[model samples]
Target: MTAPEKPRSPLARLFMGADHTLDRLLAYWFATCAFYMASLAVLVAEILAGTTPPQAGLILIGAGMAGVTSFYLLVRFSQRLGLEYWQLALYQAVWAMGCIIAAYAITGPIRGASMSLMLVVMVFCTFALRPRQAVALAATAVVCIGVTMWCMARLDPAQYPPAVELMNFILIALGMTGVTALSGAMNRLRARLKDQKAELQKALERIQTLATIDELTALANRRHAHAVLSAEEERIDGAPGPVCVALLDLDHFKLVNDRYGHACGDAVLRAFADAARPEVRNRDLFARWGGEEFLLMLPDTRLEDAHRVVARMKERVASVEVDGVPPALRITFSAGVVQRKAGEPLSDAITRADQAMYTAKSTGRDRVIAA
Candidate 1:
């Protein structure tokens, strides 16, 4: 019996990697910088109030320096933990927790320091945790804060006069935690939408390329070539400008496949395409017609000029080398070039070009025939 199908890994769901990783790192750095700024403000206030400034200043400075260093480290090393997404998520969570601990040590509730810990809950919800994880983390924050308040009460019972303050603190923490969870859900939704948008754009680009490109020769295929010719024909009529169409047929291509394998014949076609591609203008359209034939639309070119272009293309094709072939192995093409006549259909011009190409083939194997 077949084994049960394995689940798709988390990495499979994450399609955007290169840019997404950098974006996460940048978000971490910005959040870290904001944490440092808030911490700095607290430390400065302590100093101005004549609290022993040196110790607090030293500790705050150390924390800031460590944060800056960790920012660079996270940026560089996060990707090395590939497929270990939990590790990255944990890093973000733990980093935020460290800031909470730092804030509490220096100035607990006296300066509303413990209140800042709410930021940690918010960060967990925003960057690292899913709904369940966020709820668990929020519960953890509440428990920790309760324990601290209980300890503070036990240490100096008179200082903690009323339970009202404790209630307010708990309520504020819950409120912040809820806000963070809600915002995190929204952020996750946005991220998923962005990922979907990127995927759709990639699929559309692939479809566009497939629509225009020839499967065998990798040139523009017949459908695209015909469309381009028709468009150019219209342009010529509207502007009263010259446009040329050239039909190229391989000289004795059947003999090549008969002598060599079909693989070798395909190689010759690809080679011819590669050689011809650079010879045509960037604005010119090139396509593979049916077997052993090609069509080119040269906008703003006269028939004489188009003939010269195809002649050079033939020379390039003849120069290509096929390894493991006989010393006398060579390839050539016959081309029919025609100009768009005034007030005429583009298909007629293409037909005329085909006739001229056949005339060239009948007269000689490798020459251009212009009509």
Candidate 2:
């Protein structure tokens, strides 16, 4: 036999990733805003400096425009190419690189390079993408930083702080990258655990539903009714009140099955169950007692009240229509109802109800006989 299928892993389930076009668009808008804000800050700072240069200001503004426009295009590409989270992360890394380079050009290397500390972007990505994708992002960030440093070292030696300071800069970047990677890993673990719990809960509920339900008529099955009656019996601690039990059976059910196909008979049984469900009180328990028969347990109810409920249910059953059947397709049920006698076993109450039901069936088809 083939093994049962297991659920897919959380990472595998995130196949769409940033392909959710709306999400990608929103992310791009936020990144664009960040770029604009960063550029504005640098522009104002350069204005404050006594040695403000016209070329530097234009470069800062140009970089901000490019970052925003590039992001807009990337968002459209993500939609067209159906990019996943990993691909989006790679794109974000490239965007970060451009921002860092722009900052370096406007300011010098040491002052501008600090902007690459946008490793904080990973925190947002951790919650946005899966762990594997986040890891991909950390790798990309490292590459971007290395490339930016190499280019700056060759083009502008005066911008480099000192050898020791450069070493410190690399160490700080690595440290921040480590923090982002660790946090992303923890978040993914939590997400996976939550998914597993939800799956388990649904599976357990299905099992319990199957155990209590009658397969034929979709009514509560016999085992459940017996368990409920036993529990109700235990609740009675020599109290003044008595429990009421009712047994119901379809009259001439065998004859109906003989006249119509078993499928039609099954339909009739289902109709009967549906009719009975509404008549039962919230506190009452109803179940199929096997083959055209049913049991009802009414806690703390008198025999008279039970009889009234049963009468209403029987009337409803008789009124039900069996589709595609003959006009004379009227059906009836017989019921036996009894209240618990002091010092009597729960089974005795059931037995009394059973006898009363048969008495109604023998006397006539459609009626309740209370004991």
Candidate 3:
């Protein structure tokens, strides 16, 4: 038999799953440092071939080591120091400039790879820095490369003629400027997309809330209550417990609406909902079934227990006083409680509960009945 494959460790998975901006920044830093070190090795080889002085080669190696060390330390400690994006970008720009200047000083700006290094620095800055900062860094790179080449040509005419050095510097400057503009445009587009995504998420949340909640009483609507009922019925099918449902209707609601205006009736309805909400457990679903009627679902509850809960809620509702209504005015609700049979459909249970509620209304206005 083939050996079973071992699962990957959590630490390995964590490293693989890390794709945040900080991870990208660290990857870029490491890649750039590696390229610089490779270039430094090449420069040393050129020195041994008598193309560069030994003293300049030594300086280049030392500068390359220092640059790598600085980048490593900054990346490792940046989180603890709470460095922000712009701060990291500024530090990186400064570090790149320092490395470029040091290399130019050692290898003569026009004859060595200093112009190419400056182009790499500009590209990385365009990616890492903000728009205005990237533009500023590009301009600084242009000026630095131009000044270095000019000074080198003026000091050594044989190695770097003025015309050729100026032309090369202009080409490098143009390239850096183009990269900066493109990166800025990309950054702006990315920012706009992020904002739009956040707005879309909030819109979706609002839509979900409106779909599930009743507008007047701020309770779950009939549709959501039915869904909860169905879920509870399914859960209790194989379990050794009961799921109970109660249908409640306000007593003499039509009379109240006729005596007082619809505004006062709405206030009474809202007050009843507020009073009854605290009586039910958190896991129970109390939703507005329709005008002046509500449904409550209790999971893992017995019929007698549900009857007692409804009795308490009925007493609470009778004591509730709507604002602007007279103290003499009273409110009461009649409830019908039913324990769902095992494997019974939720619609059948609701119908039975509705019948019981009507029976309670005919027998007496303010009482609880179980079916």
lDDT: which candidate is best? 3
Shift in Å, residue 156, candidate 3: 2.7
| lDDT for each residue of candidate 1 in 110-218, tens digit (9 for 90 to 100) | 5354565566546555655566666666667666666666665666556553484477457757776676668667777978998999999999989998999987789
> Candidate 2: worst 10 consecutive residues by lDDT?
12-21
lDDT of each: 0.73, 0.73, 0.80
Judged by whole-model lDDT over C-alpha atoms, candidate 1 comes out at 0.73
Better of 1 and 3 by lDDT: 3
* C-alpha lDDT (0 to 100) for residue 71 of candidate 3: 67
The positional error of residue 40 in candidate 1, measured at the CA in angstroms, is 28
Candidate 2: clashing residue pairs, number: 0
Worst 10 residues of 3 by lDDT: 12-21
Flag regions of model 2 displaced more than 4 Å.
1-161, 238-240
Task: Name the runs in model 3 displaced over 4 angstroms.
Answer: 1-73, 101-128, 233-240, 323-326
Best-first order by lDDT:
3, 1, 2
Name the TM-score of candidate 1. Answer: 0.58
Q: Of models 1 and 3, which has the larger TM-score?
A: 3
lDDT of 2 by residue, 1-371 (tens): 98764555666335324234355455656765685677567666765673335677666667667767676555555656677655665566566656654555446434544454565566656655777767666666666666666666666666654563367457746765786767677786878898999999999988898898898777778888788877777777556477899899988889878988788889889888887799887788888998999999888788888889899998888888886457587778889999988867789989999999889988976889998
Clashes of each: 0, 0, 0
Provide the lDDT at 206 for model 1.
94
